[model samples]
Target: MTQTTQTDRTTTGAIPVPARTGVHELDPAEAQSAREVALRLVATAGAVVDDEKWISAAAAAWQELPLSLRHAVRAFRRHSGSRGTLLLRGLPVAVDELPATPGHGSSVQRRATVPAALIMAVASGLGDPIAFAPEKSGAMVQDVVPVAGREEFQGNAGSVRLSYHNENAFHPHRPDYVLLICLRPDHDRIAGTSTACVREVLPLLSPAGREALHAAEFTTAAPPSFGAGGERAGAHAVLTGPASDPDLRVDLAATRPLTARAERALSELADVFETVGRTEVLTTGDLVIVDNRVAVHGRSRFTPRYDGSDRWLQRTFVAADLRRSRSHRADDGHVLI
Candidate 1:
């Protein structure tokens, strides 16, 4: 299909993606095997490698999978999301062994070892090829981190924080999709993944609340993960209504309202999250995809063991095709925009 730029894309039903085939869940056995290999690689390394290195390794590992199973996953990737969301039953997450995050002295790109190729495949399989562009000098997750956040956070095997949020509300162009590959979960931790669809909650808003959200500006900042020095972040309208494809921008941690009307909209938005979002506890070897355009995602608060195998999930982002925002992408084929 020719690239869709500035086109009307909203419908009454869950905003659908013609490219999205259908939801396909992974098999437990397949997920476990990937976890096993990842754990061993991490155990050998002793520290987290960089995202690029791990991505390269994962692509290789996935390419090496048995033909039948490999073919199945390749098929699954195509039909996963509606322009955005796709869920993989497993993605090799384990609590016993995981790569360590490289400290300041070393390159994180070398430490981010991944066990399964599903993540690489999913991003590439669904929207576009995975962009290993490090957001910061040496960042981990990809998609240019088009948006950044600065919340002090950690996820235990079980304990985790899944606060509902849009990945990069501060940016001018947000991603069409958000992909997560699970490597481990705190067995004793109960942190859950939280997600909310704007479509699901739009009906609950009062007319005035809706209008306030449609206004053109509100403050938003990077999540603590990228350490956006609170001030470096900027503001954006919480929502901009269009006849089709209404643009929604939000971040629980950084978004600030300028007027009481905006505040009311924010409150209504919060209520929608509480009353209309989806919550699922991500387990070891699972992969979760979010429609960055249709839904916001976060983790429920949980404690981390800080042990070698605390709940660790490898994250990556994908923009539909970099064609629309070529100017901002890193030369390395990754979207820095």
Candidate 2:
């Protein structure tokens, strides 16, 4: 793909260079403070790591971070430019004796580890941590690794190029943000996480295409991880909010158009993504937070050996407001049942 020049003004329906990806490199003191907070939370929650009480306690502890660090997070949360993705580097994570990639097995026992605790602390700063009842048996933190027999599957268990998607787009209560922390990178370090935002590509769309996207003529089916409830989202618009700067919600892998015009519009959107998307290769101690409402994310193809040392990334989801899904959960719990 050819690269477009960086400019605020549009030139013949082309996408300008997007605002750079948001990245914050933690200083030694800030990294140490984060480690201390994670350790304190681990000590506080002795037996149960996923307990709602314990998670809430961790969020409260996260609020006590230094004002400068807190301000940076707040600013990113409110306005992360056109990319809608943020990467935090140099966070302290204990990875010694880390278990091999679990494939499709249980991750319950791994939740009590120091890395998991650290993820919770950082995720809480963005929003309330959440989980889907059907994914990984409702575990808040999930392991993203290639499975033994599911290499071609489109979901997290595959090494194939996973198409761009808004996390959990088939559900009524999709996450507002998605977090992925790297403990071990792919063996060859060739895997890349791809992200694209409508804000960066809106100018590239024709008026007819934009009009078709705003109409409710598309549907997205839930991924296999969601189990029996993996049905299609009915009659939804791909774009919403202001016409000048719209929000996006469409899974290129699972979504389908109801009409020929909608199909053409969807293809145009994909073309823009191919030209404007940014890809990143995450390494150890790197945490990436994606604004799900504004950006769509996907993964590139990589060879996973499954030799207990393959690519391993821990993922967690968050919602800006938990109360919206109050009725879907029981007793104000974190998981949506």
Candidate 3:
């Protein structure tokens, strides 16, 4: 892994910033073991990825995975480490068996597949998988692929550089963990997923900046991904919890500062994030998990051919404690209204 203390100005805009890369690769034997579990899951009867019964089966299959994989995921659930990100390489994705990257917008994986099985199993290890009704039609497994006519859009369908943000930052019941699995890379393999953790940015913040960010002086609106008609978050602190290690809750593209000092603080926070952020170019079978409570994530710009070979990634959101959001979910279902 690489580290830089110098501040980077390019990241203040949409340009990609130089970043440290770290990954935990599974051995051939371990990867094969995971593949076996995924194959069995694919063969299960009524293997719909989003159905409550299927989700329960996936959760049960979690215990059948390799011991190493289960241990690593459980440990991450307890503590996300200093970077608040974990990249697991060599998962059981059968690239040759996959279909063409979805060309339409709001693509989701409803049928069971090897990649879906792997992602859902991991989601069960972290927590129960959850989804918002307004986002991606409340699908448990959504496709993060570029779509035609949405190149400049800010959501998953766009190929442009996405700004740093906690997934669903405007929602009171935001995901505690965001899981993304790579099924295919972009034509150029240059598109990188980046993350910046508050643990690293906290130490670099000025006393005044920290004070301002801790106050309830920021408001965040819903992103384009959620469409329209959602309520915006009221005045809230960008950083919360203990000062030594605070949780981050602001989207650079949607969060607005309410006061002059708050504005300066927000700018300073962005700069510090740029200074410490890291980007990783994920490959097939790679799974990156972001601790949403402690870090903000984004993507670097990439040109999508719009052909059948565009980059393809599958995403799932996890709630560490599902019971906390019971009121928002109707009939104790996974989809939150």
Off by over 4 Å in 1: 1-23, 28-84, 92-116, 129-162, 228-235, 241-245, 335-337
RMSD in order of candidates: 10.0, 9.6, 10.6
lDDT of 2 by residue, 1-337 (tens): 1345433234664633333448877788988887787777778845355787778876887786554556666676788678888888887875675777676633543346666776777778888899988788888788888887788888888899998999988788999989898888899998888999888989899999999999999999988777655678999999988999888989998889999999999999999998889899988888888899889999999998878888888888988899999998988899998
Predicted candidate 1 versus true structure: per-residue lDDT over 11-116, tens digit per residue:
3334333333334454667656655554554554333433455545554455544343454445544433222345556455444554542222112243444533
Q: Ranking under TM-score, best-scoring first?
A: 3, 2, 1
After superposing candidate 2, which stretches have Cα over 4 Å from the reference?
1-21, 105-110
The number of the candidate with the highest TM-score is 3
Candidate 3 CA-lDDT value: 0.91
What tens-digit string does per-residue lDDT give for candidate 3 at 1-337? 1233233433454433223343567899999998988888888889899889989989988999887677677777777878999898999787888889999888899998999999999999999999999989999999999998999998889889998999999999999999999999998999999999998999899999999999999999998888966679999999999999999999998999999999999999989988999998999999999999999999999999988989999999999899999999999999999
Among all windows of 10 consecutive residues in model 3, the one with the lowest summed lDDT is 1-10
* Per-residue error (Å), model 3, residue 247: 0.7
TM-score of 3: 0.93
User: Candidate 2: lDDT of 95?
Assistant: 64
What lDDT does candidate 1 reach at residue 80? 32
Would you estimate the TM-scores of all the predictions? 0.68, 0.90, 0.93
